[model samples]
Target: MSSRPKAKPHFRVSPAVLGPLGIEQLQDPALAVLELIKNSWDADAKRVKIVVDQRKAPGKILVNDDGHGMALAEFKERWLVIGASYKRALEKSEGGRPLIGEKGLGRLASFALGNTITIQSARESGRSFLADVNWEELSSAASLEEYEVKIRRGAVTNGTRVEIHDLKGAWSSDHTEFLVAHAEFLASVPGERFHISFKVDGKAYRVKHALATINRLAEGSLEMRVAPDGTPTIRKCVINGADEKRIVFRDMKSDELDPTLAGTRLSLKFFRRDEAARRLSGVLQRNEVTEVLERYQGIRVFRDGINVPPYGLNRDDWAGLEQQRTSTGGPTLVPGNSQLVGELHVSKRAQPHLVITAGRSGFADQAAVNALAKYVRWTVRALGTARRAEHLGISEANVRVPARIDEGKDRPRTASPQTIRAALTAISRSEVVRANPALRKKLEDASQAITETLGQSEESLRLYAQLASTGIAATSFSHELRAEFDVVSEAIAEVAASSRKPDKELIDLLSTSWGRILAFAALFKVVPVKIRRHRKTMSVSELRSSAETILGLASPDKVTTELTIPAMRLSIVPAEVDSILLNLVSNSVKAVAESTNRESGRIRVRFEAHGNDLAIHVADNGCGISRSVAQIMFEPLEGKFAEGTGMGLPIVRYIAERYKGAAAIVRPPASGFATEFVVTLRNVVQ
Candidate 1:
């Protein structure tokens, strides 16, 4: 047998690969221009200008920068290379600016904007040269080496100029505005000396960073610094300018966080949109402030004072702030994305593991990125807690809730209802409270009420959990039961067809009874399962009709109900609104039935328009609630009535808060009613 000789083969690439590497690498023309500007920044350019000439068809774009330009040899070796980044060996430029381009394909981003690009460079001591490339020609070539770039010597200043011709799409005023906005953001990067200017059709556009103004007008802010070892400290926290306090979190370690997050700093500014508009009225209009917030609301990532793409954009929820806002038990605690703007600062020199994606869309999916997200979420939670404490005039120490309980075992246990009750008892009997008779009495009363409410809540939660489990089984059971019923129905029809008159009548009765039983089973199956609801726009008449139908099914025949709704449309989740009404009306009916002297029971549900908000007034003529009980009525399981589970009002309040509104007991109840509850749905009409 003969042995085969070994052969070596090399990889050859066609110019067609540039389609994905350059033309399709960036879908947006504005983003491609930004990439070119970043290259100028990396070159230590002190001044950069971008001109978009749209006065004629097939317009051209010119980007000029005064920086350290490349010579003929450097251009041929570095600029012509694809995917071989010279920046991989250099951490910073000669002028000490942090290098921004790493993929080496940023120059090719020009292909996304146009087919032809002409580049002219003039070095300080070397001969200036110009190179022209036609992407279409290169793309059609069989191999990368087949395409040629026209080169010529040039007598120009020390800088670089790029002219893109044969535009892919028409540049409109909207595109110019987009570039202008991006330029303002770029210029706003801290510690960056590079300046960028924009011109549309030879008209110079001024850039004003609105973020600076927003930062100044923010109502609440949190600034934190994390050490290399993962120890986080609050540098400054202004919850409310009127009264500020320092908040501290104890025993937190970076063990769970990625070590790459070391030395990361985060600063968040929160704005109550309406309040911010009022404060900025002298400087910016309400709509302008709104537009600014809408454009830049999420937390952005900045590495070495350079803005990263796709993080803070309107559509980006990289930090999951919007998700948290809609998560279970988060509506009241977490602020929506539109209410916040923040910056997460990392360094290329310090946190090297935080690598950017190849496409430059965002950071790579690694432990460091996940750790960054976790840290941001924790910071948001802390800021929210501090803000709430300040607003309520509560001490930061009192606001801290135990996350877990020490069970005197190998593993700590989550705090249970019993543990919370025991802790409340201990608090009421503390020495400080016991020393004062008045305070001691108040504390005892409060503790007792809280204990009772806790018990009721625990019981209700247990039952709801059981019901959810049962619902799963009931769904399957109902299907089978329906099939059996259908068989019985068919058998009855057969018997009626072959029997005498009396026997036929008996069979018909049995079928009707079987049908009623099947209907009951279907109703039973639905009772344990919660309906998933989606928000939809409905007219006033539609909403009214739906409410009436719900009331007819849920309300007692003995009680009279009246609904008054404004003649306007609303966007709401019908199921949520139904839940709110059912709970309120049920409570009122109970109150009326237990009244000492009442000829008739009446419940009035009136919807009133308060500016952009929708106020739902539920009033009833029933045994009135006392000032004391009414004060805590909306609290979970705070109802004092014997037959009440006390969870109804809390559920109502939760739904209201989910809509950025509140549920309150209206004191001095509405005329002709004994007790009144008002649930406001914020901005429902708008």
Candidate 2:
């Protein structure tokens, strides 16, 4: 009997896989072109040129590079194979250039911009190969073998050229401009790295490299280095004459007041509008300054001198500068994202787990990335604070008290602190010792009274600011108190019904609601605490319990509370401690109450010894404060939330300061908690 040979089984790929759908992975046409340029860069090409001719219905795009090209065997195995990565084998080129290509998908990006792609490459051996992919023809084929890629071998010079025609769509002038700009930015490295030039319809388009150095023009700067263990050391530098001098200040580590910063290096430069204007006056024209400010204004991430996507985009608020400035009413002096520019450098060796997302949209959404973003936002706010402080100093120096000293008519206004101090010295030396003595006595009494008044004025202003913040919070707290009472009233009705019916569950509910009412009542007690009259050494455990007690009383079973306080004591006023706990816990409880998520809400209080200070964290699994809101939330009457009086934080701040401590909002650990405010105070034993 004769038997036919059995058909052998093998993998088959449909031609449709190489059609337009194949290039869909690249979202933007400009990005497709960029991918090609990047490939040329990875190829160690010293000179790369891209030209676009769009005068016809279907334009022609050509990219030529002088780089060592591919051989026939390499082309068949790596070039034609999708996802083949030669970069994985050789991390660097023969010329020692770090390879930027991986995943082996960049070559396919050509299909995104054109229907037909033709490539001709020659290696150092003088052997050349030509290959072309007509996606339209490939789409008609049933399998990969149905349409064969024609290959020719010949002797040619060493280089590579890619020609794309039968364009998928019309390339607008905007696209051309973007290509030119993108080419300039991508090739912003030293000339030794690569030289990339662009042309449109034979007209050479040069990118005006007018990007101003933010450090050179910055009025204030903040440089910080975060260790792998999250320890952050920051320096606040102010631009003085011919040099930037580091300004000495305590409490620089408070980015939301964190004790440590992990895994990032942030350098920020802030230019007040006027300072920017002055610096750019000689280098850039008035219109150019405006344009530069508009073009570059946000914190951008750079990995090995190349910018990562999305961070520097106009809409990206990687740093919450704009909102903080707007909400705080310091638009002129408070540098927003538009008035600030800086870089956050991350290394693959350092941040090994910080991976980029597919299509380079942004970093992969994960805990590390979120923390990085939070820290960056904090850095921006810190720089803004520094700038505002400098501005205030300038304004104070320029302020004129207009004192007549010995009542010798109107004198010229002193424009500087030194001048005013000198005038005061002269008044005391010459005017005060006159025989008449009346003017001297008058000046002496007036100076003494003014000094006392100034001291009183400072205290009064602080009190007023605190009161205003408290009043705003009172509005919200009052509403919350009333709501709790409403629940209590409903519970009373339930209890009455239960009394008649003898139902245990209704009685329990009534009891729980009553406890909540008492908790809400306890909150009011802290509000009236105007002085630290009740001073004592309190245990961290005691502090947590007090806060938990208030929360338990106010909300009952509406939210769960956890306390992880260490066995530590701090010398402070019991009432002041109560205020801090009450404000933070109440805020946490309100946050959880507002969440629409059906999951149970939680508040966590933890305390630990941090160096010579005691650190307490009041965290909650609720809608967290945004970067912007957190910046100014401590300001009197600054918060815009429904249940927030904005007074709680101010009071907390006041109490912290009174005890030689600080209060700051920190990025919460990823325990599903949204808000974490940390209070750091001296670990004084009494």
Candidate 3:
């Protein structure tokens, strides 16, 4: 029978299979951006405008594209397809360039950050129409088939416009931050073929050219292109403002056989940022060319003349985002082994892949050329070289061995860290695995195992540690009180011995002394404490003396110790400091009990300033905690450590927190098992 051919097991993924992942599959607002841009690109719009206004609570965003427009039937067929368009169009070389929005999901990017989404489009066929979608309605609907839509005639003459209103998921501040990130992305769009403008709170956020910093810094030019046979080759390098003085570097030889110099490639080039300004602007303006041809900034790297992994040169105004506690913050330092360099593969599909996350995950799986992974290491070295040159104008050759780390990725070999970043970066990316078959299978398998627990675990650990530390502090306080009783008894004995003078004053002193002693003993018996008379902020000098007092009283012959405190103002209640001091002294005495040279076992305490932070270090020359031990020391369960209720450090940590600081067990004073406690406090006055 002419029955349908057996279905291949390959194309098995259904929408039901993709529906379960809420955040990973859909949370990236970046995808939505790709969608909006894709649609505009598909329309063949010469100019596209992106507007973001946080002043409107949920954020008012609109993307306008002046493209060839669409017909009513075409719009119904094309615009309505979600995740289906790319499935049909991915076979071609271009991802629907004359059209761009191949992956239907790009249109939903607006929904990533907000709820209500509005789309207005006009075509050459019937008439302009507007479609409003309240995503909240989708949840209660029985199925995710084509939604019920309210369509009305729109006023636009041509092209399409999308307005995302009443965005529900976030507030205005977050919207402003998103706009700043969007501006950075706009700078990288093909300037010759694409035009984009972004306005945030009335400020023009989009810059139509390369980064001014990169422009101001570009010093030279180099280009690489694939051979007719598809072999990548690097050609001539030109020194800018140096009269086109050329330097011919041979193509890098692949030493796949030899273990040393295996996959490593060293590329050192300098560019004047101004020289590359408007590299995107088609038909470069004469004035800009002249400006670029003159003096410029330092070094930068490019893959096929397009800058990738922006080596900290482009100040995208998101620097503030990289410093705070927000998940958004973290300096945009392209890590040495990171896979963020999606610019290396500059073929037709390459550049697009670098801009989206879906494309990135695929590139990280490649075995032939883990270029992004390789190039990151190079970038780090170049950064140090750049820093040294900026500070002292020294060539990188003068630095220590500049070598790459070997991660056994792709081909087994060594690569300087900078080159690793270069290797990991690429040029193109697609969301659907089918879009890039080479990466689809692996990425899909990995996506399934992703649980919410991975990222959330950091906070979980912090809470657990906080509780454990508090419990330890309470335990240590009890140990300290028990030890203090003997000292009180000895002090009274000394006073009684001096009362043998038999004078009138001695007789009266003896009578009151017993009463005061009884009262002192009663102080510990009751819940009352002389806390009001105890703690206050003290200088380094006072802290030093307290250390000595606690040590001298604990056990003078047990072990010798040293104290190093700089003359500076410090903020810590003296009572707290005293407690910390006494605990540290007692621990040091115990550490040396079994030492061969018991007299030589030593502990040292030092307080130093690091920028605005205060670091108080307590070090010992006894047995040290191993890495495995150190990792779990802060945990609730401690190893079988004698003389330790496992609470000494936890209490130290608690005291540090009350002072708004952190405490950790570090290296001791130059011996095995020597433990160091580090307390870091913020904003020390001096």
Candidate 4:
């Protein structure tokens, strides 16, 4: 009696709700145009023409395609229906073309460009259906059926034409350029003859599919092609404008089989900033170079020749180029999002799992996307390394040394204690010594003071270098910590915003962040401890083993490292040994990663005793150091590689000199190694 009836509410949505949100979702006009093109593709159109007529009043955008069009009944059931899964129902068109349009919302994107849209479609039956939409009417409609959409039956011959009128805004030059550049992707379908011609103000420009050939404006470029079976062939192209030479590399892994690299063929071009390079690139004027850079800037992902949005956009660093540079603590010559221009060619047929998102901003958030990102990041680094080497050879105006010490005949030399003692002894038995005994004693005391000062001076220089190295290391450490902290902070904030209870995701995030923090803490503990004067007995094998272990912990698991040292003791500071080993290993790792010939790289370290000194040889099978870098390998300057802070080799030299040792580059004794560095250290009594 108390509970006579329970009330139930039915939820209803207005069709006009999407009128505003759909327009807002199309934040990019280029993306809106791309959506229309995708729709044409999904319709199995073999030839599509886009005519941009802005010279006249109101302006107009007409997209005409020769494809299997729609009938009146089908148009009412699917075309006019919002969020219809008609494409998804069949999965493929009648002509066997994969349905590129998933979300029905793409059709609504027309509202972002113009106030009026007319869709005319026809099947192979030589008859057509026409439907016209007034966006204003749809927005003010009280109900879905209230808006009047003009529809006609058997209006035209077999084909589809979309006419957008009353342009919302003017299309800028950048928009046109975007369309021109993206045409290559749109026309890239294999074994299919698809043409997309663009016409503006009665002028026409046809987009070409140029994936099979490359036209790059750089000093050097690396092109990598991976087959479906995971076989890779690498070609290094040296472009001196019209004179281009290509060197093909064989027997390299290329990491094509990696989960992230599956079904992706990479083409990475390296650019140079030198005047010579700019001139060679046919950029005669500064403005011309600017235009070229503007047209071909950023890394783009092309799926079956269609440019996927957001990946290569100005602000999108899908390849993590900036993060990789930051991780290396230096300016990446590997090209940031704004500097490098290339394409990650993927095929929908080959990589079905790499699904595009409904928003069209990028691929869906999944492991495959992450893998693609990782592979791209690695390729960027590799290209940057190669380009940096090429850039070093470009002559500069100033031929001065990077570093100089003031020690010449023109500069007065400071007298040392030994020089003063020798002078005094020369006059000790002479009349000057007898005439002024007090003077002789004063001279001897001054000599002792001078010797102490010189000792202090040496110590000061050593400390200065150590402090400089530490300052650099500290800056990098802080950057890494800040990045980790950002993740942790985000996770904590997410957990706090939860409904008063932590879910499994929140717990996992907390655990992961905490683990990363702990790992960094452990890594920080191994930062080389400066112990210039503190000599300790250390086993060569033990030092190498410890350094390798620390390197293994810090480095990515892909790098292969091997340590070869006899269990012999050396009377030197353990920290210095660690510093030497660490720097060399780090350099080797970078070289290996950058090498196109050796995708999966290896570093080998061997220790040998030479008389009263220890010669530690560190080698790698990476892209070898150029002659220019080799000549100044230990010159106490930043090495001429992109992945370096210009301090790694210098640090090695600094530590070597402190131990009365020397670090030098030598020819590798074997074929397996690309570059070899020998560090000689003096053996002392501990």
Error of 2 at 137 (Å): 1.1
Lowest lDDT block of 10, candidate 4: 400-409
Judged by whole-model lDDT over C-alpha atoms, candidate 3 comes out at 0.44
Candidate 2 clashing pairs? 230-261, 230-262, 256-665, 469-636, 469-637, 472-645, 473-645, 516-553, 519-553, 519-554
Q: Write the per-residue lDDT of candidate 1 for residues 122-214, one digit (tens) a residue.
A: 778456899999978888888887688899988856889999999987776656766665666667766766678888888988765687768
Tell me the tens digit of each residue's lDDT in model 4 across 555-643. 44566777777657778766566667766776676677666534477788888876667888888888787787677766643354432
**Separate clash counts for every candidate:** 0, 10, 71, 3
Which stretches of candidate 4 lie above 4 Å from their native place? Answer: 1-12, 54-57, 89-93, 96-98, 146-148, 201-206, 209-213, 216-261, 271-294, 314-317, 322-341, 346-354, 366-370, 382-686
Best by TM-score: 1
**Reference-based TM-score, model 3:** 0.42
Q: Per-residue lDDT for 345-462 in model 3, tens only?
A: 3332433333322432222223323343233233333332333233332333334321222113353322332332222121112233245564444333222211112122223222
lDDT of 2: 0.60
Local accuracy of candidate 2 as per-residue lDDT tens digits, 377-465: 55665554445445434323234322112125553331233332333334434422344365455434433432333223223323333
- The global C-alpha lDDT for each of the candidates, from Candidate 1 onward, is 0.66, 0.60, 0.44, 0.60
Tell me the TM-score of each prediction against the true structure: 0.57, 0.54, 0.42, 0.48
TM-score preference between candidates 3 and 4, better one? 4
Cα misplacement distance, residue 39 of candidate 1 (Å): 0.7
Worst 10 residues of 3 by lDDT: 317-326
